[model samples]
Target: MSYIDGFVIAVPNANREQFIRHARTFDPIFVEFGAIRVVECWGDNVPDGKLTDFRRAVQAKENESVVFSWVEWPDKATRDAGMDKVMKDPRMNAAGDLPFDGKRMIFGGFAPVVSLPD
Candidate 1:
C-alpha cells in the first residue's frame, strides 16, 4: 500500500491567493521528489467539531477556514526519503512568506482506509 501524508491548516480568507501560489510553487517539487500524488483543497464543507476532535484526528478548526491536503508515495521509506529532499530543495525554502500560521497547521501520515475514484 502507498504511504500518505495528510495536512489540515487554518488559512485566512484574505490570504487564499497567496496560499494557492505557494501550493503551485511546491506541487511540482513534490512530484519531482517522487510523490505520486499531491492534492490540495479548500475547506468548503467541514463539520463543526470540538478541540478534542482535532487533537485526536484530522479535523478542521472551528473558527478558521482550512486547506486540507495530502501527498502520496510508494511506501514509508520512499516517502521519508522524498520528504528529506523536498525539505532541502531551494524551491521549498523560497516559500518563506507562507500566508498561513505554521504553528496552527495540523499534519500526519496515514495509511488509507479507502480511496474512491471520482
Candidate 2:
C-alpha cells in the first residue's frame, strides 16, 4: 500500500498565483526525491460548520482560501527517507518567501485503511 502525506493550509486569496507558482517550482522536488505524486487543490465550495470545519481548522480569514493537498509515496520507508532528503536539498531554499502562512498549516502522514477499486 502507498503512504500518504496530507496537508491543509490557509492562503490569502490574493496570493493564489504566487501559490501556484510556488507549488510548480517545489512540487517536482518531491517527485525527484521519490514521491509518486503531488496534488494541490484550491478550495471551491468549502463551507463553515457549526462545530468544526476546514476553515476553522486552519483559522482561515475572510481574505484567505483553504488549500487541501497531498503527496503519495510508495511506502513509509520511502516517504521518510525522501522527506529527509527533501529537507536537505538545496533547491528548497530557492523558493523565496512562502505564499501562505506556514504557521497555520496542518499536515500529517496517513496509512490507508480503505481504497476504492483496488
**Model 2: ten consecutive residues of lowest lDDT:** 109-118
Estimate the TM-score of every prediction: 0.82, 0.97
lDDT of each: 0.79, 0.97
TM-score computed on alpha carbons, candidate 1:
0.82
lDDT by residue (22-71, candidate 2, tens digit) is 99999999999999999999999999999999999999999999999999
The number of the candidate with the highest TM-score is 2
TM-score, structure 2 vs. true: 0.97
Q: Which segments of model 2 are wrong by more than 4 Å?
A: none
For 1-118, candidate 1 gives per-residue lDDT tens digits of 7889999888777888888888888888988988999999987766556655432344334445767899999888889999999999887877777788787788899887776761
